[model samples]
Target: MTSGLVSPKRPRNLAERLVGEFTREIRQARLRPGDRLPTEAQVVRRFGVSRTVVREALSQLQAAGLVETRHGIGTFVTMNRRDSGLRADAAEIATVVDLLAMLEMRIGVESEAAAIAARRRTDEHLERMRAALDEFERLLGAGETTEPADFRFHSTIAAATGNRYFASFMGSLGTKAIPRAHLKLPDLPSLHHRDYLASVNREHEDIFNAIAREDADGARAAMRTHIGNGRERLKLRQESSDNLEPRRKK
Candidate 1:
């Protein structure tokens, strides 16, 4: 079947936009559980995106436990909205205030998790984090959606804490943990988007370096600073939007 998804006027991460479209369809009961999604080729034709983008979007849906792909068959919806008790809907997190609230929660939870991870992480955990960071950099360079890699990097840190609960908590947040994945901001200039993402990766590097060196205090500080910087950036964006509101109405 053809999709009714429409491309936005401004540029966005295509995979993320596809995910949002699929999510909306699923949540609205139009695509119920057990319904097969459009084939990857179909999706490519319908959305006018590359197969790579379609695969990435499907991978994210699988990661979120929303769909299961059967070998040689097709991807089918696995759950309805009510089945996931802890999901953070992008629609629900539409405002800057909501995003700030999420970051506030992350700052408290992740800082401690980073410290604990530094103390308890194994070689495998470090390798995973490194791979996630590498994937993040590659995707950013390719101008693809980096949300999966970003989520993987943070989730790896949580996993390194040697506590299943920490990992579970991060998994429950999923890509929603990366604010840029869903935040409803105006289209940013390409230079601005690249610079912003590069800055984020640098912060990720700091957190990784601290964890790799087993510096619990330093890791904790780095995590705090990373998340705090996100909070500040959102606040600044909010302020800028507020400043522009009057002119837009004229």
Candidate 2:
């Protein structure tokens, strides 16, 4: 009979270590969409790991939708350039088409989220929403940026919908959405006309009112109308831009 014995040297656990490094780099956003990642051998050299460990780490990133490998080309940090959800851009030659696609996606998500929140919201959730709304108005009235409040408002709605996944996704993405939403809001101080903002404020109130009443149908309708109104306004703005199209116009 042979006695069992432990190995003197411990395994490096290279896969775990490589994954940690990769996760850190990706999270720091040093590796953005379309960014190329190092090759398998290159990754191994960087991590001081064997080839298998590098492959495992890369595979994990791929599974997480954080990266992709081309058949003959190198791996990329981000696979889906359309991850932003809104499709509009003028930087590229084909940006206008993409922007339209993006807006369509935003319309679908915002409308549905609103509808669902109506059916599911609780008093605590409404309180959270009101808090966010108050913060937004307070800051905006004070001639300061209200980005924090803006994020919280959307975040609260997503949470109120009783879907943890939706809430998490919104929290992750709301920072990007708010800046764009702020741009879409018509100028008040600059134009000296607050009607546009007032209108939006009313829409928000109508949404809250429906949710507070537990009027699921009303909430859905309110949210759908609100999202549709935004889309229509954006479309009209686009048409207005066409009327004054300078050569450099986005």
> For all the candidates, what are their Cα RMSDs to the real structure?
8.1, 18.9
The list of candidate 2 runs beyond 4 A from truth reads: 1-100, 179-193, 242-250
Model 2 Cα lDDT, one tens digit per residue, 133-215: 67657755775544555555665676677664555455333233332332333223643434454466577778778877878
Cα deviation of 63, candidate 1, in Å: 8.9
TM-score of each: 0.65, 0.52
Worst 10 residues of 2 by lDDT: 1-10
Model 2 TM-score on a 0 to 1 scale: 0.52
Tell me the tens digit of each residue's lDDT in model 1 across 1-250: 1111212332236777787789889989899999999999999999999876776667566556567667689999975423433344443443456667889989988999999999999988898789878988999899987877887788778768866556556655656678766554555799898999999999999999999999999999999999999999867765655332211111
CA lDDT, every prediction? 0.75, 0.56
Query: Which 10 successive residues of model 1 have the least lDDT summed?
Result: 1-10
lDDT winner among the candidates?
1
